[model samples]
Target: MNAELLARFHGVIPAGGVGTRLWPLSRAAAPKFLHDLTGSGSTLIRATYERLIPLAGGNIMVVTGRAHRTAVIAQLPEVSDLDLVLEPEPKDSAAAIGLAAAILYRRNPETIMGSFAADQVIRPVEVFQEAVLEAIHTAATGKIVTIGIRPTLPSTAFGYIRAGERLDISGAPTARDVVEFVEKPDGDTARRYLADGGYLWNAGMFVAPVSLMLKHLERSEPELYAGLTEIAAAWETPARDETMDRIWPNLPKTAIDYAVAEPAAAAGDVAVIPGVFDWDDVGDFAAIGRLNPASEETGVTVIGDVKRVYSDNATGVVVTDSKRVIALIGIHDVVVVDTPDALLVTTKEHAQSVKNTVDTLKKNGVMDVL
Candidate 1:
């Protein structure tokens, strides 16, 4: 990758989402991104920033919620106040990403910005950076590009991207034209897609020129573009807070896929670079078990102090935040999370349904735990 090309690239980290499925340990006050779920001694967001530093250098921005501003700052002290974008309320990815694009466009129209989620776990940072380099190269050719993960399995949890044909763009050998963006398919459809060999998991990672990004947003969603433009114009001024407070609430809420990528693909303005790297979103306790190394003796994964947790004939994940000793007996694939105010016990098979428990707690007005 050319140093000049890399210098023009800016990284955007969208660090939102409460991660309800990872409850007890992952709460509204402190989401999963703020926790060291992988036992790598670094929080997810911090790891994400470090992963991008080699490619993006100091040109990185973090978009998070207002409530997490202090914590985000505490975690990423290198992020300047100007680079930290705080949303008053959740308005989905379109607003978050579009606002970032709009603001960067005002500063430099030639900017090639890549948006990577703050919560995903990607390994072999060098491979990920190579794919990003190709995506950035492809994006420089006046097309919106996304780094699509090569599907390892027929996963219904993520959307699929259909690759059409290889592109002859310079410096991007694996670049392909995106045929279409498909929603999460049923089990049968997902299996068929896996067998098709032309599908990739839509990882929601986008790389595009700031100008082109805003152009598509303006065409697909004019109202959202207009509102974001207003806020971006005042972002570096004294009226930034007032402008965001007044206009942000009215911006439409939609993911970047629906608001930009899907429409851009339909218009034949989208391309994809297949990323052959290990990636996991860490969606639930099951994912936590997958990411962390299990104890060899007990066949269990433990976060925090391992000495405080004891298991006999158990195979699962245990997360402890309190001093209380946790003991498990004869349980297979169980998930035990012990927090100061809440405790969650479930099996790995039912980990995805943990979000339902959070919903029920909210419905019953169990606000303290959430």
Candidate 2:
């Protein structure tokens, strides 16, 4: 690993989003990032931290909601209080990452920060590390660098990054200029992107100098930049809580992509390093089914204890943490999620609409299940 290059960068994890699609398994009180959806023996956040700990060392920061602050700390006990930036409310990625970047800038203007989400799943550590190292090198050249996953399939679930020209940066031979950022496309557009071979899936992992990111925000999102700077000024002082209360909620709830990346790319300031690691955001049961190795045999996946789950001519995904046995018979392409307080039964094709179920429950005042 590039020890010196790694030492020059800090890791920032934005951990606020509630994975609504993975509902039942992921809830508002305890989001998906705090749970081991893969049964990997560690939570997603912990896995994310361990993935970067080698390169970032102890200079890692987690920005999360006030409600989840304690759980985040509990899950990541190695993280010090000073490195944890607690958001009083959910203000999306722009505010969350901007707050972290502003604070890192205050600590040292030269600090290089890379922001990764808390819920992503990446495999083959060596390949991921190589990509990150290249991304850091490219970011050091004063451009916003994003790690782009090579498109393995014509999947419309992710945004595409159109790469322009190759960059001449040492130790980052694969670095290329980002032509533009494309939103998630229709199936035909996605298929064309795959066939054309110029687009990379925007993995949402960004590496940039604190100054460059803040400068972009200042130009593209002046109001949010002002609020972030204000909160950052009082971050380590007694006025932190009061200052945050006054400025945070009023900050624009925009994503980093819309606020900084798209504009920066249009202004010729974004680069991408192609990552070949196996990655999955674990967005839904269908995604989880694909990730689980056990599902390969009969297209059936189980998240909890396999001993407690039995199936006869069944083919789908079953997840449960409850002690009660879950049995499925002659069911195909179904999703069964059993929780202590709620049970969700749906087909794999409709897994993406599970969040709609949560919405309906909320509208019906069925707070007990939600």
Candidate 3:
């Protein structure tokens, strides 16, 4: 491990999403990142923290909602009060990451910050480290860098990043200029992207100098930049609560992709470092099924207490957060999730619509389960 390189980098983790798609198990009170979805005996947020410790050491900040602040702290005790950038409300990724960047800018203008989501799963740890190191080196040169995942298929679930001419940076041999970021495409468009060799999946992993990130934010989102700068100025002062509560909710709810990356790419200021490691956003049940498939013998992917589950001729996923015994018979491609307050039963094909279930519960005034 290069201690000097790691010393120059700081990690910013944004963990505010409710993850409505993985409902019943992932609730409003406890989102997916708080749960150990991988059955790896560690929560997603914890795993994310572990992934960055080697690179950023103690120079890491986690931006999360005020509601989940206690849980985030409980999960990551190593993080200090100063490193926990709490948001009074969810203002999307732009506000979350931008707040971290602005706060770090005030602390040290030259600090290199990398933002990684709190709910992603990446394999081949060595490869991830290599990609991040290259991204860090590229970001230090005043370029906003994003790690672009090599596409395995024409996956419509993720956004694609097109690569332009390659850069001749010494440490970052695979670094390339970003052409444009394309939103999730349809089946045909996705296939076309696959046919073209220049496209990569946008993994949402961004690295850049704090000053560069703030400069772009100030140019593209002036109001948000101003509000975040004010909050950062008062971040350590007694005025923190007053400043955050008064100005946070009223800020625009936009993602960093639209708020910064897209515009920056158009101006030829963004760079992409191709990441060859396996990655998953774990967006829905189908993703969970893909990551941890059903056992060949039992034909069931059980998340918790395998002994508590009994399956025969059943092929799908089963997630339990309680002591209840789950039994499935003659069911195929079905998803059963059991929690104390609610149970979600849906087909693997309809897993993407699980968010609508949350909407329905809200419409019916069923806040207790949510």
Best by lDDT: 1
Local accuracy by lDDT, each model: 0.94, 0.90, 0.90
**Candidate order by decreasing TM-score:** 1, 3, 2
Worst 10 residues of 3 by lDDT: 1-10
Where in model 2 is the C-alpha error above 4 Å? 1-4, 295-299, 305-307
Count clashing residue pairs in model 3. 0
Tens digit of per-residue lDDT, candidate 3, span 1-370: 3466568799999997888899977877799899887878889999999989888988899999889988998999999998998888789999999999999988888789999999999888789989999998898777899999999899988999999999988689999999999999999999998899899999899999888888888899999999999999999999999999999988988999988899999988899999999998899988889888678888989887644888888899888878898889999999999877788899899999999989998999999888
Error of 1 at 211 (Å): 0.8
Give candidate 1's whole-model lDDT: 0.94
Question: What's the true lDDT of residue 75 in model 2?
Answer: 91
Q: How many angstroms is residue 198 displaced in model 1 relative to the true structure, after the best TM-score fit? A: 0.7
Maximum-TM-score candidate = 1
Look at candidate 3 and tell me the lDDT of residue 118.
Answer: 95
Clashing pairs in 3: none
Assess every candidate by TM-score.
0.99, 0.96, 0.97
lDDT of 1 by residue, 56-79 (tens): 999999999999999999999999
Q: List where candidate 1 sits over 4 angstroms from the true fold.
A: none
lDDT of 2 at 104: 95
